[model samples]
Target: MARNSGRVGDLPPPPEPLAVPAVDAHCHLDLMDASVDEAIAAALAVGITRMVTVGIDLPTSRWQAEIAAAHPEVRAAVAIHPNEAAAGVDEATFEALTALARADGVVAVGETGLDYYRTPPEQHAAQQESFRRHIAIAKDTGRALMIHDREAHEDTLRILAEEGAPERVVFHAFSGDAEMAKVCADAGYVMSFAGNVTFKNAEALREAAAVAPQDLLLVETDAPYLTPVPWRGRPGGPYLVPLTLRLLAQTRGTAVDEFAAAIAANAERTFGPW
Candidate 1:
């Protein structure tokens, strides 16, 4: 018996059952350390049956399309991120992204928009131009537009209005004040909340979430990034979506089950069933 005391490798645990029907409206699964297959499997185990993998550049956009092609549950959103726009996106990059947007399983045309935090004023014009191009692509291709706005809400809103953005526009990881939320709501835009809504100083965010129209609300992990509280200090993935959903449900004064159902319906409406 003493001779058999050495530790044996632990058997892998069974996959957790999917909780509420959840769709990670935005995440960089392709950029994670895990292989695409493993990431999809993990996401499925957690009930994250669907995901939209976004591209920050031409190469990544191509990769996103490839992931979509291989995985039935994954969809692609092709665009040039604002920061990458500053480094000088070429016409060919736009062309390539446009082609990808039209590809099967490509659900949206962004993760694009303005980001003043990393882009300089000198390059603001280019960023805006790139954004307009993406909006046009969304319109022409009939794909939903996922906008990434940070510290550039005014310009972001202004441009979308001016460019005649498609009917399906989402403000991914919405980081705006109540006023901005009101503006978006007025425009009939969808606001997708990330884990940031669960932060201590996110009173405004919670308020925004509470007031958001029922049909327009969405939840996402933005994983490997803004992990929600309870799991805030840890690495994130589709598995943690329930934590965010619970917080969102609490903020909205609705049952978690109801909120989850609404979000799944919203995702289906915006990106279509996978």
Candidate 2:
């Protein structure tokens, strides 16, 4: 229930660095006010050496591609978010997004799936069309697919199976129970945990995290949103990933150092090397 005000000025300071370096599986550097270099440097100083900056639309997707191309520590994921999917994609925009997906340093095609929470029922068809196109693009380009499923789990999973999921499919900011976790695990999908898992009311998410296979488990900030506990509601960036990561480690009953290493390995497997 923590909402993002999108106000970055008053965010909390970064916590101490983790014992093992980690990659923020997902984030949006273009949404923040800080320069890309500054954000990368700040995260690197805290042992967050790498991150994937995602794009929700054509323009932002282009921005992410450019930034990732220039920065060694960054990668990009491009797609139109499910909420935006209802807007209907024009042929021109689809062409542009397709080009960006094949661009250098673009590691995935996603943050695209179904979101019934904020999107109206009238637009469900459009969302489904967009999701299908993204799935095809991911498969065509042979890149990972980062999915954003909200309140449309069954439909999302159905479409993924129907369209044939890409080799690497990640449920970013996974919002599901242990049952759903098993379904995704059985399908060889990655369940990425965001800061919301730290909330008191998110027992189901924690259970999902606990059941997630170590090799298939991933962590993300999804910033500047889903800022971890005590810092929830404040703007966040990759530097804040350790907070959620520590919680994930505890939920998995593994030492932070060991778990962090495993998460790093999982990132490599999902998005390709660094």
Candidate 3:
């Protein structure tokens, strides 16, 4: 049978100016069900020139690295996520992830950290242990630590400080409350907001976006998941980044174009150049 071609559904109108350089800081492009080529084509059609594909486990981490290797516009972040970390990452898995981190195009070590929300108490200890191991790898390799903190703010912050994470730590899909936001901001960590910030009940998130230090702010779609408002019904991609960008810009009281430029530059600083 001839292969089906192109993405389904109407493509969102391309961003104006047609040359904006946008970086999607977090996405599970590998898990999108669609072909990576199709996703890339769709993203490019909407002005996303670069993306960071994140991994949640050993096999997926390796796949992320492979995706980065295949696509010049893509980079990888490898680690066992907090929910998956409960299985207790084996030594071999740690070594494999560390090796992938050292590989070219692997920019960070994570989507790793505490997620007490869904993790059962029986496996919480193992999750913390796994988090420490990933932190150590980040410290040793000097790769940025991409953290995923969900309903475990204090523990996450404590472990991050205790482990002495590197200067380039990033809190992917950061959902911390005001005080927690202050803690991360004080520590100079990057807080990446996603579509969650655009949700109707996300006033706190919007507030966090407002007070996040200018240089420390970043944006992501966390695509195929937290599709931002205005594009919530649409399939997620780097192309929809502008929707989130516009929301953030409005919340931060900055021009959309100016904020877009800053986010692009911030992404480059955090994940390195595309």
Candidate 4:
């Protein structure tokens, strides 16, 4: 994964901490400008104390595991992302990725669902195949399945059902509207919202947020991508989670502290003891 370019006006000072600490259900610390320790410290300072650093490829997956192993606050989710899976990646590499998924402190096998948005039509087969493989790994290892569903919502859901989704399935940076939220809610999938849920124009997402069961809701930064409103287009970090969590809380009409606590509990349920 490419690191965020710390261009002028990109990295902003950390926002005020949340009233109570909350977990960042998904993130990509390896893709940010901060080192693992630096990112962890910054996040901890803001009550974003625990996070799952996701992998988009084998090397980064291994790096994610390494960071998780070294830091109690960080857990890892390893997988070859849908876009990367479409690239001529070999089976041996997937075997290696599966090994990484099973490593100590590796809580999930994911960010691997379907992405019709960026991948070409010709490569959809490859992406779906890789997704199935990741599903198997998640099930076999008894780890949560972290999904990255973009425009391929139907196929993503279909494939999960076809393969018998792992007991713990997370829709990382969930991009669905209320209808899809209903489907996920009925299927018992955790919908992890990122900063985009705060956009003024994202009423649909906010509606979906409201539809999600409180126990099934989660939060993330997806930094340095989806930086929340007021700081949109700026590079994001875990410390900025309060902005998104507050927005989610407001959308759900819950107190910020209570919402944060629910998210923390949901985090443990989805990813296990991290």
What TM-score does each of the candidates earn?
A: 0.91, 0.96, 0.92, 0.96
Put down candidate 2 lDDT per residue, 158-221, tens digits, no spaces: 9998999999999999999999999999999999999999998999999999998999999999
Which is superior by TM-score, 3 or 4? 4
lDDT of 1 by residue, 1-274 (tens): 0011122222123233545777888887765545677767877786778888888888778888888988899998889999988766788888878888999999999889999998889999999999999999999899999999999999999999899979899999999877888889899899999988998989999988888898998888776677777555455666567677788898889987788889989999999888
The per-model lDDT (C-alpha) reads 0.82, 0.90, 0.82, 0.89
lDDT of 1: 0.82
Candidate achieving higher lDDT, 1 or 2: 2
Candidate 2: the clashing residue pairs are none
Q: What lDDT, from 0 to 1, does candidate 4 have?
A: 0.89
2 or 3: which has the higher lDDT?
Answer: 2
Q: Indicate the TM-score of model 3.
A: 0.92
Candidate 2's TM-score: 0.96
Model 4, clash count? 0
User: Which of 2 and 4 is the better model by lDDT?
Assistant: 2
Instruction: Compute the lDDT of residue 30 as modeled in candidate 1.
Output: 60
